[model samples]
Target: MLLASYKAIRPGMQGIANRLIRWRLDGDYSHNEVVFEPGDGVDHLMPDGTCEPDASGALWCASSVAWERLPATSPRRPGHRGGVRFKRIKLDPAHWDLVKYRRDPLAAAQHFKRREGALYDWQLILGFVAWLFRHKASRDTCSEVCTEAGGQLEGHRVDPCTLHQIVAAEDRHFRSLLWLAAAGEEAAY
Candidate 1:
């Protein structure tokens, strides 16, 4: 699953920035994250043949080397004015095998963990403003981290929306799971 950061823009000039980002990126999503596993408290069969919450098995998320184990039902990002959405990608058998058997997701998450001290790529953001897609080895963006974890090497200078677009285009398995407004209200579309 993917978690996106999309906020509702109020009227007047303050909304301009949000509008601009949406327009420039051609998408409402500004950030992305991967859900590695189901969290405890959620009903699911376990390998131990036991029926209980998996405290260590909570919804595991990896973002740019920072790992967060959240409750299964926790809001994507609580108390933030920005909205959040979750998406599920139904991979084909081949990709599924690659992910499951090869443990690509875990490897990707580990790759980010290995580079935990990396700084956020502020210059890359500047490049985005300048419409430049230049790569920097020292700094990294969230999307770049995620893509790298997913075994995609072409994420050196990609933004969140661009990353989503590229993956969605290359693979036809993307699907929306849920959408939550800034007020924590849920919606179908």
Candidate 2:
């Protein structure tokens, strides 16, 4: 299946609001994986599927599977407060496609740059192959990682310590940012 990105959000096919795109990726291929991102239509669903937000939001649309197949947690942990909906994630794509797509160095490099930088959590990047993008032992570890931006995701590697440093730096920066936001009486997402 070809996964395409949609500009607007919608209720997942299974009737749940896809608050985020959940991508479960393994090292070998991305087809079976999931990606999570901020979702729309969050206002339509309530803590218990009743009541409405001040206004309804957009919905998520992925070229992947049916929305109902996505995961969900009830009450999202009590307090009867706001409901936390979907997340958009990145997953591995098919391998032949990976190579074919990788041919475009400009695109591949851009994809790698996005992931290599601080935007991704250190554990997420260093352990990329272990989770959503784990490559089978038969496959080369480099295949699991890509040095290119369009996410060639093959025959590439990064030092684990470097990944940790990136994560730590990001954590500190985020914490400081949060503190500043709180001090100003506004929240940052």
Candidate 3:
């Protein structure tokens, strides 16, 4: 999933950081994640300890995030608020542009599941914004997690928006799930 921050201070936006990220990276999206479980045929356990019925559906995604509200299921870093987190999110077009990748799902799932508690790479993010320091990322960012899971070796240098382009260019490797028409215009089909 790729998250767009095309508008500044839009509703549901976390803060100005997203806009800054877009500006610095020159990309429409500021965040990305891997949805290992598409929530089509299996029930999901919610953060509040309730079983979410599979009939409704939810995308089970994982990434390193710095959002205001971290999902309850996310593992916490010792002194920080953000890190690698798993979330159950609806595949809403308003927020996310979904992409389907042709990859080994089990391997990707296993790779990210082991990184559940990894720290968010603020240094790398900061490098993009400040254009200064380039630290060895002992931590991971959202795009890094997604790309690495997708078997991209150059994940470290890619951002959310760039990943979209990369996937788009590789037709056999990825496919977009988003429809081009507006929501109400789907009936025209």
Candidate 4:
């Protein structure tokens, strides 16, 4: 229902919605959850579970965080509707990165184009970090992964390098995911 509602409100923001769902969790490595205000959303589907009108929501799901947290249902807060609310959400880790993958297609297709700088950059980084678990080698093998799309691996605050977490690891991991999409265009043949 969240995805459907998201698609309805702003078809383009579906990617954002996907990440928002992933953000409902909290744990060690990363706390990626969205605490919703009562009636704000996410509870419309499970009106029975939540008596709070503006409940703060959180999404504590992922590979690394799985270490400490349990499924959202078992250990969820008292006000929460438990996993029954998200029972249908696809918990597969592969899909976990789908939000990251759709960034470019949605952008290149020109679906969502607004805002700039850190917020924009973090959108990409969050998605990339969602699935980016590798050595800091995105720079050497990939050019688009650099900050500003194409330039020397100079001093930049964010980029694939940052999210990839290396000396050159800028906070622009989000762009790196978009770069991945741009590069994929070549392989379409």
All candidates: TM-score:
0.50, 0.22, 0.71, 0.20
Give residue 64's lDDT in candidate 3 (0 to 100). Answer: 77
Better of 2 and 3 by lDDT: 3
Q: Would you give me the overall lDDT of model 3? A: 0.63
Candidate 1 weakest lDDT stretch, 10 residues: 94-103
lDDT of 2 by residue, 24-113 (tens): 221222211111113322223222332222233322211112212322432222222221222233322221221112133334323322
The residue ranges of model 4 lying beyond 4 angstroms of the native Cα positions read: 1-30, 44-48, 51-64, 71-189
CA-only RMSD, every prediction: 14.0, 17.8, 7.4, 18.3
Candidate 3 off by > 4 Å: 1-13, 38-56, 68-80, 172-189
Model 3 Cα lDDT, one tens digit per residue, 69-162: 4555555553456777766656567766665555666556656656766877888887876778674556788888778877878677988888
Clashes of 1: 3
lDDT of candidates 1 onward, in order: 0.47, 0.28, 0.63, 0.26
- The per-residue C-alpha lDDT of model 3 at residue 17 equals 77
**Cα error, candidate 4, residue 62 (Å):** 11
Error of 4 at 26 (Å): 20
By lDDT, is 3 or 4 better? 3
Would you list the rank order by lDDT, best first? 3, 1, 2, 4
Candidate with best TM-score: 3
Model 4 residue 164 distance off true place after TM-score fit, in angstroms = 17
Residue range 1-189, candidate 1, lDDT tens digits: 333333356366546755776677787555555544432221232223232324543333444421222223323342222222222223233222211112254465456445554555556656777857555676666677767767767666666677666666544432222222423453333
